[model samples]
Target: MASTVCGWCGDRTHMTMVTDLYQLPEGLWPTKGYSATPDRDLPVWMAAFRCPNENCQRLSIGWAPLHRAKMGPTKDLFLREQLNWEPTQIRRPAFPDVPKEIADTASEAHACLSIGAARGAVALARAVVEATAKAKGITMHGIAPKIAAMREQDIISPLTEQTSHQIRKDGNSIAHGDIGEELMSLDDAAAILEFMDALLDEVFQRPAKLTRLSERGTQQAPGGSADGATPVQGGADFSTPH
Candidate 1:
């Protein structure tokens, strides 16, 4: 009787159609008055709904038996039409705390991946590397070159050519490859994410320069103690023989 625009089509109002008792399968029809069936039957109680939109006259045709679905608040979580169909509930996730360094690496790795959804992971790794380098007073540009220089000066260890090669390869992939081309499986994505984070930790995280018990040592503590130590109480040099 009343006209209401279809949510999907926007141009046409929803219309309902009804079927005669003979039209329905014998056993499926309600035994009592034609109107005795439940609300769900009301739809089937009649014919399916059709979109009024002339251009997109989509039909809402389906076989749904009488049933009840628990509905929830329609304000924030639920859609209006959903109330007419099936009910659903919403829940929020309980997020855990993440370490700053790990968070940074993940952000960087995410930025580096062009293929698939792994871009986020790559960006995280890159962010971690860049941030850590900056904190260590290292240059962000020409990272491989900077790393090489540090290796040569014995500032960093185990800086193999492989590391540089991987960075270049990964960089090229992220920069030039089609994002949709190389969609990796969940396992592969996880592995790569782990690798990225581990690599950042391995190379970028400067180890706490062996914080010695006392600064007065025979030889400068191997990694050249960065933590400046002070003389023992009474200005007594711990290095002096008793």
Candidate 2:
């Protein structure tokens, strides 16, 4: 048995065989058994495996077929049905440098997107833009004006402003029940989320990284000479004066 990542425990483990291979009877086959080509032999297999992790010794049912490959034959497991698998809430990306409230709202928007809540996702995305603008001290009557103000202040790029405005418009359509605007689709919601990620990266993450690097350079430079060489501790410079 090859070592594989256990989905339950999130650990590397060798699967333990729990059941014998069971092949379906030929009478149940619909004209053809699992073979892709007539010349190749039919390959059908079913078995159960147990996770080796002591904490998560869950059983999983698997089905596969021996596939003919260009190099040789290979076993391909197409189905992995874990009876003990429990659905977990989707995790959202954490933006540590961003304000806690804004980050949490953005995370909720992402979680909504993951579960096919497109309208809710877009609504929360619009909220994120508003929250971001407010956090940046850009006070305006509407989202569009706030976005434009941000653009004028050079807080965000023109393209970012345009995208944020568009997202706001889309969310407004859903919120106001506009018959003219189509309901938010999954693709549209995903695109909005992507734009939000880019905006947050530009506004928070990149600047934080640059600030940290600047601080580090300043700290390191104190011990270095003007010529970019580190000064020896307790040693006098003996170089000829230029």
Candidate 3:
């Protein structure tokens, strides 16, 4: 099996264990499978895996089915269920070095996603965007205005502003139950959360990385002078050995 991200450990490590495999009886489905054959011919696999992270070596189980295309040269295996046994396990999005409040809200959003609460997840994801904007001092009255302010301040690009507006609109529809707006689906909620992840990277993670690099360069620079005096500009001997 190929390496996959462990839901338990939250790591992309090589860890997969096939516990069982079986083929369903023939004529189980009235429709054709991906191979245009009967669905009963498909192979169902049950697997167990351990997280590779030393701190989180928890076990997880998954079920998947193999599929083959009829007209194309495509064969694929898709996971139907992948879950950790413990309900209280940590499940978080992969945005590192985010502020505590934003991270906490995003974690809740992810939990809601896991439980199929699409509306709740989208609401929390919208909260994450609001918190991020507030952290950056864009405390406008509403999410749309805040996003607009962020774009005005060059905190986000115009494209990102449009996307944020769309996310906020969806979240508002879920909150207010607008008749004309479509209900939030699981995929919709997940997409909003994914956008938040990328936004955090752009606003927080990348800036912090550049700051660290600058500080490191300053710290590693050679001393000013032999007597601890400030070196004059263009006065240092470039040919001298350290």
In model 3, the runs with Cα more than 4 Å from the true position are 1-90, 94-96, 179-183, 223-242
Model 2 ranges with Cα > 4 A deviation:
1-89, 179-182, 225-242
Over 4 Å off in model 1, which ranges? Answer: 1-116, 159-161, 164-168, 176-180, 203-206, 209-242
**Between the candidate structures 2 and 3, which one is better when assessed by TM-score?**
2
* Pairs clashing within candidate 2: none
Say what the RMSD of model 1 is: 20.9
Q: Which of the predicted structures, 1 or 2, would earn the higher lDDT when compared with the native?
A: 2
lDDT of 1 at 62: 21
Order candidates by TM-score, high to low.
Answer: 2, 3, 1
TM-score of each: 0.35, 0.57, 0.54
Top model number, lDDT: 2
Model 3 C-alpha lDDT versus the unseen true structure: 0.63
Prediction-by-prediction clash tally: 31, 0, 0
